[model samples]
Target: MEKQIDNHYRYLQQHFSYLIRQQALLPGEKLPSERDIGERFNLTRMTVRQGLQTLEAEGLIYRQNRRGWFVSPPAVVYNPARRQSFIEYVSSQGFEPSTDLIGVTVNPADARMAELMKVDKGARLLFLQRRRSIDGRPVLIEHIYINTALLPGIEKEDMSQSLTHLLRNKYGQAYHSMNLIFKSTALLEDAARELGAAAGLPGLHIERTNYDAAGRVLELDYEYWRHDAVTIQIDVNDA
Candidate 1:
């Protein structure tokens, strides 16, 4: 009985794998309903679901609420050392990119924030939250803290667009240096919620601190990315 059940799921997995490899099920195309697949395969619904879950773990498919599974699209490449903005890189890769400002607020820096920004406690900072998408699929959530003292009246400016552009054109400030840290972990509750993913899903966490020519911290950014949505590539040159 155990061997038979194992073969049952493997049979469905192999069938879908063949279809995907042949391009019969194109990327981003929805799969058939679970009931339909079960009926076609002469398997129980649980067995069909188990097979689909296996493919999802292999990065061959993904599920959306209400909507069924879809063939996974090609992962976007992100190079940490690259100076391109999110829109620039995504567009260069032939993907449509967009940003939605979740919210913005001015708040006093707490102890940890003060330490990170090298500012005194209670220093005013701008908190900005944004959700970024590629090809209409929400993939990243960014929480940014800006040192308001560095750019006077910055809070009055539009916050939805690229900060790099705003700094260069408006404040005459550009990125001088940055420190970045990347971690692979489960997505947190708030970030997962914003990305339309279930809590505790595998994710990529990126923490970046931006500095100006004078070595003052300009912004501290926390980015949560869907695990399957991005592929990070970096080129190192020997000194």
Candidate 2:
């Protein structure tokens, strides 16, 4: 029985994988329901799920909590070396991008945030949270901190638009330099829920510090992304 289950799961994986590679299943196309798949393959639902999980791990597919599995879209190429906004980069790559402002607040910075922004511990900081999507698929959740003292009245601007564009147009400010740190970890519950992803699912975390021409920290951005939704590409120019 165990051997039969092994072969069954492998068969399921290979069958779907072949169809995906042939483009018979286009990106974002939904696969058959798990019960249907199990019925077709004469396997248990649990076995079918295991096979689907295998495909998901290979980045060939993804599953929403109750939405079933879908063929994975092409991963958006992300270049930290380039100073481009989410809307700009995603559009340049022939993908639609959108941002939904989740929440915004003005609050005193904690000791850690104050040290990072180089402001007084009790200084007001603008906190902005947004969910960014590619091709109508929610792929990123942003937790951004802005040094309000540096850019007064910024909180009044429309928060859903591109921050990079707003900074340049409204304040005549652009990032002169930036610091980025990355890690692979389980998605936070809040982020996962916002993206319709399963809690504890593996995802990417990015911490970014943007600086102005005078070397003052302009913004701090924390981005959480679906692991399969993007590929980080950075071109370094040492010369």
Candidate 3:
């Protein structure tokens, strides 16, 4: 049984790699039916399906009901030390950058948000919610909290473009670094609405704390990435 499972996995790895290299399994392209793969491989349909399932679990593919599996697109790898806007980062990779402003307002910071943003409770903060996309498909939903005192005119700024750019260019605030924390959680209704994900589906949640050059808190951003839409890569250097 162990060897059988191993063979199935090994065969799947070869088939998946071939598809990727050949563009047969193009990024965001739905895979063929399990029956079709089985016929092509001369293997049982169950085995083909199991292989696909393994690929999906490994973050190489995603499944949608009635739509089958599709190859996942590469994620935006952000360097914490680099001072570039999200749009700039995405555009550098030859992808179109766009933002859909879900909502934006100034509100009193809650306890949780205060801790994340390093602000006092009830402090005024700019709360901006948005769905970021490359081309047209929604990839990430972000909730950003900006210190109102730092960027006094943040509310009047354009909501359609990169907030970081506006802050650097208009507010004269330069970003020094950002820390990202990751966790797994089920998608809620709000997340589903922004990410086009089904409610209760699993998702990748990331909390980002951005700081200014002077070490003042710039913004606290929470982003929810749709499952299968991204594969995160972390490069660690031994000190």
Candidate 4:
């Protein structure tokens, strides 16, 4: 009986996978409800859900809260060596990009933050949180700690726009070097809640430290991304 059920679900999975690959179901297209799918396939709702879950795990589909499943868009390609801003890269890929400033404040640096920023403990740092969306879907949340001493009066600028642009245009500071680390992990409770994903869902975590021309730390950034939303690529060339 279990084997039969597994084959049944596999049939449904293959059916949908075909449609998606054929472009019969375009990206961001919604899938029918479990009841409808079950009725059409003569399978139980549980079986239908199992098929959909498989596709979701494979990054072919995703779910919105109470909105059912959707065919996922192509993953955004991120080349860390390129110095393009988020807006630039996202637009180059033919997707609309936007950012929402969730909060901004100046806070005294704690021990860990101070060490990361290479600043003394208790030094004031500008903290910013933002939600970044692509094609109208929220996919990444960013938390940034700015070294205020380097960019004095930065807090007075608009935080909703790209900080990279602000740094270049306003302060004449372009990114000189960066250290980055990426990890595959489960989303934390608060980050999941903000991204409308269930707590403990698979996610991608990125830690980045930006440096200035003088080799001083400019910012420390932590980013939480939906596992399906991005594909990281790096190019290697022999010097």
Best by TM-score: 2
Clashing pairs in 4: none
Which residue ranges in model 1 land beyond 4 Å of their true spot? 1-3
* lDDT, candidates in the order shown: 0.90, 0.93, 0.78, 0.93
Clashing pairs in 2: none
Find the 10 residues in a row with the least total lDDT in model 1.
Answer: 56-65
Better of 1 and 2 by TM-score: 2
Per-model TM-score on C-alpha atoms: 0.92, 0.95, 0.74, 0.94
In model 2, where do residues sit more than 4 Å from their true spots? Answer: 1-3
TM value for model 3: 0.74
Q: Candidate 1: RMSD over Cα atoms? A: 1.8
C-alpha lDDT of candidate 1 relative to the true structure: 0.90
lDDT of 4 at 239: 85
Screening candidate 3 with a backbone cut-off below 3 angstroms (N, C-alpha, C), the clashing residue pairs are none
lDDT of 2 by residue, 1-239 (tens): 79988998999999999999999999999999999999999988889988998888778898977889999999999998888988988999999999999999999999999999999899999999999999989999999999989899999999999999999999999889999999999898899999987777779999999999999999999999999998999876679
Ranking of predictions according to TM-score: 2, 4, 1, 3
After superposition, the stretches of candidate 3 with alpha carbons farther than 4 Å from their true spots are: 1-18, 32-55, 63-69, 184-189, 199-202, 231-239
Candidate 2 Cα deviation (angstroms), residue 200: 2.4
Query: Tens-digit lDDT track for model 3 on 1-239?
Result: 87976786678767896877687767888777887877877768777876876676556776665677778777666554556677887788777778999898899989988887778999999888999887666878998888988778778888777777787789887677778898888778988766655676677898888898878898988898876665556668798
